[model samples]
Target: MPMEDAGAAKVGPDDLQAMRPHSKPNMPSPFGRLLDRATYWDLMIVASATLLVSSTYFWLAPQSQGALFEGRALTFPEAVYLSIVTFTSLGYGDVLPVGFGRVVAVLDVACGLLLTAVLIGKVASERQASLLLLLHTSDTQRRISAFAKELANIRGALSEKSESEATTKSNRAELYSLRTLTQSISNYMSFNGFQAGIVEFGNFSALSALYDELDLAFEVCSRIVHGSGKNSDAVVMARAVSCCTRIYVLVRLMSRLHRSAATRSSLFGTVLISLRLKKPASLTLAEAAAKNKSELLFQSMAIGLGKAEAWKARGYHSLQLERVLAEMPSGSKDGWGNQVHKLIAAKLGISNSVASKCVATLVELGRLPK
Candidate 1:
């Protein structure tokens, strides 16, 4: 018994070896590999199978001298070509199959056509996926570029505010324009009409003016986060404005829900909520259908008052404002400032000398110093 046990327990190295060297290391089988490799060749495989089935039918069919001579009696070359053509259902009909032979040929062609279509559809679907991926990649690059520009603009605005230079009249106008650009958000929200009953935006009421300004400022930043409007130079600020509108609409619509006694999210100071969050649309840019799970997508944006501090506080600085002033009409790098002055004079119905003095007065103020 001991001798028998020892012989049975002996380990054989040969027994552990695989029949083929390419056998898998960890996986149980080649199923996944087959699927991947087969996906691309699906159409070709169908075409080949279609040809095979059609040719096989012709070859095995009751081959007698008369049957062989009839229905454009085919050899290997002709039969293979006919099989392929029939399978694809693109028969030129130069060689026709008649009677019972025609029936078999037609059946072969139909099956081949159906399988070919399925394979072609799959290929089309894959191509669409690839195109979508490319578009998503392009959008991501744009977002990165926009983010960098915003950071630079914010820095410039802050630097101007931190300066020790005297404020000039030109500087005031430049500041006003920058504020106007930032405050354009009210228009986006006006379209939504969330605040129609409670307030009218623009320079309407004394208290309303304050509310209007807030709405505009909030909208501009929101659009920036969401990437609104056309991707044009003049309309670059549209996205930021849209984001602002979305929030105003949300607050007006959800004010009661947020104010509910049991609600967890704070409703107070919710003016900046949309601004504080990233937009849903920007996230959905690549997706026709959402890849993520969420009830409201834009809430992901972080457009809060704190976020505003990063950009808004810089605008309040003096030296930075001076730089911006220098870059404005009189201080513009482009010669267009003079043309703009000429146009302004024309618009105001003023004389050439008056326009010159106005320009000089702006220069005297630190606004034109940039």
Candidate 2:
């Protein structure tokens, strides 16, 4: 219909119909959340367990009188297969579930219908939003962004599997270790040193949980090197330790470099030892001459920290890095570890501007991420 035609109804772009907001259905139970938080593998195992339990429930459902199909005698796998086919509405007509299981099958079909309707509606809205999004972006970047999003999803899925694999075999500590490093950095950048340490330390305690998490992790590592059966036997743990050693040395060295004389003395020992084990490489000017304890500490941390910069000259995102580092215990004035951040930040290739802002924020109590 032409809008300009006499007596014709007109609809403007703003007056066009709009889709409803997406509804996130199928929220997990509290128990599911508890499992998810504990370990991804825990989630998988629990779900597998639930499938087994539910199969039994479905199996126990009473048979109906004068029924056409009796899937009650089917095996676990067959029942599950039939359940999937029914729920998806594929109904191939090969086999059917009968009796109370038939009731279960009907309920599943209803759930599937509700889910499909919601998903289709949501997809329509998302396509509209995506069109709006693309209006502002070039074709190339949009494609690139979509590709990246897909890649990220794949990586996330793989990471989940890896996390679960770690949990099942007693190598789960590395999950916490990676979590600690990630949390330590993220918490500090988004929160503060004492706050970050406390949060991550709590996570450590929850998993390693010997009343004192940090102390326990340190003890476990010490014991493993010194021959303790209780220590992590899974090689997955070695990666976290190796990563931690590098990060610890990096942070320790930075703290000493950026702290006062007294602080340097405290952190120097930790920095040197980490470097000796990790063998982080040094950089220009930093390697020239580490005259004092602080300088020496900077030299050590700079090695591991420097390698990261070398790899990602501009990709490291130093604005967040300095904020995270500054929020760490090692980055604080009262931090007991030998500290070295100023030159370390510079060596890690953070700009003078970013370094200043991070330090400024650290010395203050404002501008935490939401």
Candidate 3:
């Protein structure tokens, strides 16, 4: 009994396994695979060939075995005419399938219906995709145009030399507007679909123009800080620097996305060059100058605010420290005092003695603090 029990225990799992139905993965058949891989024109050609072959079969079959047109075995032209009428399910009744030809006609009708349905679906999907692309392009154009217009307003405001209370309030408003635009752009680009669409079909000229406008904004802000001498408006300069940093990061992100797309194809590189979307030598030089100016502005703001340590923590490192120091507004009130120099030296990983000497040279060159 014990031996029998052990035998049953071992055999039970095997019996259950044998009784269970095995399932194969639901892979598509060869015809289904062909349908999926074929293009619209390819499918059209296939459908045409299928219709012709069905007609030819009727024409070649024995007089008594195949379809008859007008009470007689089909001629070649009559066979084609019958095939069309049957495939469309028109049932004209002038042509009649006899014997095994009825079965062939039924199969041909099924294939014709399937291919027609597939082609119709393809047409609908293509139209939908094109409509979506058009909508995206229009939306992008509107946003870019609005962004450029806002930047132009800010530039005009900054170009003024007035120092009245009204002007100050206006400047503050413009800065706020800049921040709002930046936020809008950030939110818009955050969507994966939008990012992909832009990378694939974005207007290169509009993007280039937007970038140039942003660079101009940076230039205007830098000019205001440099021109204000030792009494530079700390609040305005700080706000401008914050906004510029965000814009710069966003620009770099867009550039990186486009660059990655370009790397995917040699054709993309050629297209970019032809469209002037790729930066030329002059544009590259302008970009470098803008970067240097931005750095100087950031460093100047940090020194004025006594936030050298905070600036260092933000991962900003000046490559052209000497030129930056030379161009920076000089004076004790702008926080270029001796003690502040030591703080700059410490945060920038420079010795106090060298920083002092550099300051001395600037002062001797008539760039004295007010």
Candidate 4:
């Protein structure tokens, strides 16, 4: 369907089918959530400790019959107390284990030492993870600051009239650098560490500002790339647009996770504003549906490829530079092998750059069958 037909659309079976909302998943119980939060290794350590104590108690109960301070068999409770004390290396003189019981106590103590060592290692690992995460957060902040400065320079250069070919070439080169920076930041921000940081530290206000700056940088870069006929490949433009769009989508997703309604709404508004800033050259069914940030533009972009398994496996939450792989399907008759990307951009209300990226991603993921 053409862009006009998609916009002035009619209700059809496909439209009705796509409109059907999915059922929400059942929420986990409080206890279940606690268990889910616990590492399996920690649970195993507790379980093993319990089993070892129980086994040691059973072993000592029968052997310490009439030989200890009590002139009868050591009861299960006494055996249990002994097991615990021995395991902890708390050699209290209350219960004297003679012969085989001494061996049992030694075994328990040794096991206790091993368990203690394991626990210490686990604690060290957790501390190391925390330290590394702190370092990553600091580095991300520095990068954001650097990118903001670079954007400032680019904006200054863009405002000036090109006096010569050299100046024009210089500005274009700077614009290209700006594009690369946007891509680098996009890649950096997509990591799990950044997502975890958003939850651990309630600094959405700062992050929201960063996202806004990024949006500005990307917009300026997009204008430069599209307006300058120096780059004929539309994919370059698509990549910039995709990066900007992905940033908004990821922030929106993160806002949901961090429960920052204000940040989420702000990003949502930014996305809407972004769409209106540059009226796309083409439209499709998918793009037409995306009137607001509440609509999943990037999410729908991933879905439009019809490669859910590949998308999930790669843990891909953002669109990247998949639009303009010159090496991608140049030999194909359909020109890039399929028009799926076109549909994707149209449906998501994004530019050709984003659509190209969607296609490129599918091609790279091996989702498009041979």
Candidate 5:
């Protein structure tokens, strides 16, 4: 088999592994790690403060002067118990402070109220963190499952062609299904949660698997694009376009993940969700059936890839570039190539080399005036 043929090879679940290395669960010092966590630190701080207050009260007032319970002087144990109850606002009222001890008891109660608030806030924050992690993980799992099904269907569609109308309809249906899955991924990944979650928890495996599937999809599309005949061309083009859409969405997602990871998974990025500028098309396959292979390919490059500015700069097919140039007003033809190149570079976040390639393709296509 040729390189492209090899590239188009189907990957089963057994063939894909999550990209990141498996971290051995540290068996030692579980408690130590817990203590190192922020939640643990918060609890310890409040507990130490309570202990300090209890020790101070125990020393300052004798049993008779400091506290009385059922006409008995408070024991050391009883003083500690009072501190716990006061700090928690549990006020059993079984023990009462007397004399100078009353002043210390009142202060302890005030401190307790503040500490209680802090503890509550800290616990809530910890729970929120956990919930965010869960959401990200669940979303990742969902994407992985969806990708598996999509890739399997695409593989089946491209493996053999059928002359029967039923087969053509089925291929078209599969193409649309893949497009739907790709759009879902686009929407999910546009949110910061996906990137942040993967970075923090090292879910690189899922990400790696995603990239593998995307690469395979591209291969499948490539095979179809080169081998498609007039009868199957439309269906093949639709599938190819769906592959491009998936690649584009996945690439953007990977870019965001890298950015988030580079920042060391900051709490701000991980905890706070960012808003998207606009809603993306809910259905990407709406035009798949209408476009021929060449037209579909250009459309995929122009819109399916991403923001025009971004993908144009990264580079699009010369054919797509030709279409773009041909559509420009005749009056704007002079020095238009440089302007388009610069526009692509500036808007698409691509390098000058890529922008130049896009312009070169247009020139090669003779879309530029002599």
Candidate 6:
């Protein structure tokens, strides 16, 4: 086994101990955790409870006798009104607290200030989150649009009968750039906690357009391979394979996210049912459901055309791009043709007979070697 693999496999107590400090540094304090978990409704409930408790003390305490409403003893309703006024720092002056009631009033004012601060902080954070999300969405959409246009230009270049060396070099460079961009976008979508946000914000249309562009890129790759004839440049072929494989991984990642989100929604719905609560309709869920049918169809078609099963047979998992490239046959057109056949078969997940037929069709269409 490789040294890294061996180290990963033999994770002993020492390794865990070494990792502990790294994990503890960012741990939230109890109060911080409470604030993070608290919702607006939770804040409202806490405020209501505080008011009720304070009002009860003012109404029942002997020290509060003849303190409120110009020396008149407070009733429960009058006490509640005083609590609200005090909590808001209104100081209407109609009600006055004397003796021990004065101390309670001071503490109540402090609590009011604290709660107000927390409420302001919460609102500010939410607005900040919304602004960040908007910026991210806009940036992502812009990138995707540029990527699609570049892919289209490359596809156009690939279609021309007369290809200059300079043009070929340019196309290769563009393909490499596109592959890098695809990987970056995939990482962003997968790791940045934005998948739900993407769905919620109705960016499925953008994603759908991206998928379409990737499909065009795949077609462009087939053409490149076909035009290379018997003496294809290994570097160019490798680049093409890298591009296609990355696109495949991206599609699978999306499909997996879609399925996982659906599962989460279903589980959450079940919990709501058991708790006798109405399940709130989620924009993410609604948008996902609306887009699911067409997305699945596109995925199925793309997989069928690409031969997804052949990729699985070759041990090409979503994160194993290096392995896929390492295993690719180098410096031989016949070898690359067979690889392409497998690529199509693996991506589409077709039966062996279907795969063979697809290969034969490609061969007849001059898209692959016989």
Q: Which model scores highest in lDDT?
A: 6
Q: How would you encode candidate 1's per-residue C-alpha lDDT over 168-232 as one tens digit per residue? A: 23333333343343334323223222211121111112222333333444544543423311111
lDDT by residue for model 6 over 1-370, one digit each (tens)?
1332212212222322221212133554446645654667766876888888889988997844425676678889998988888888997889888888887787778888888887888888997867876887787777667766776776665532224667656766766676677677676565532222354454666666766776777666645533443233434544555566666666665655555444333333545645768544554644565357436644654554354323323322221222333333455455675456466546655354545554454445554442
Worst 10 residues of 3 by lDDT: 4-13
What local lDDT score does residue 270 receive in model 5, on the 0 to 100 scale? 26
In candidate 4, how many Å is residue 199 off? 5.6
TM-score of each: 0.24, 0.21, 0.42, 0.39, 0.39, 0.46
Clashing pairs in 5: 18-205, 19-205, 309-348, 310-348
Per-residue CA lDDT of model 2 for 67-145, tens digit only, reads 1234445655665666666667886766556656566667667765655564455556676845744552343334334
Per-residue accuracy of model 4 over 221-330 as CA lDDT, tens digit each: 44533342322223333333333344344434443433322222222243544577533233233222222222343344334322322321122223222323322344
At residue 20, what lDDT does model 2 achieve? 12
Report the lDDT tens digits of candidate 5 across residue range 1-370. Answer: 1232222222232311332223334422433323323344555665687667665675457875587788887667777887777666787999887787767777777877765665676566787867877886777767666666677666666543646778656665666666667657655554433323343353455555565565566556555444443335344443554455455545544544454444432222323333333332222232222112223333444353344223222434432343345444354456565466666556555566655665565556565554
Candidate 1 residue 277 Cα shift, in angstroms, is 54
List candidate 1 segments past 4 Å from native: 1-38, 63-72, 98-100, 131-370
C-alpha positional error of residue 178 in candidate 2 after TM-score superposition, expressed in Å: 54
- The predictions' CA RMSDs to the true structure, in order, are 26.1, 27.6, 20.7, 17.6, 16.1, 12.1
Winner on lDDT (3 vs 4): 3
Model 1 error, position 50 (Å):
1.7
lDDT computed for candidate 2: 0.38
Residue 297 deviation, candidate 3, in Å? Answer: 17
Candidate closest to the true structure, highest TM-score: 6
Tens-digit per-residue lDDT, 2-64, candidate 3:
232112112121322232223324634445434544566666676788789889989998877
Alpha carbon lDDT of each predicted model: 0.40, 0.38, 0.57, 0.46, 0.53, 0.58
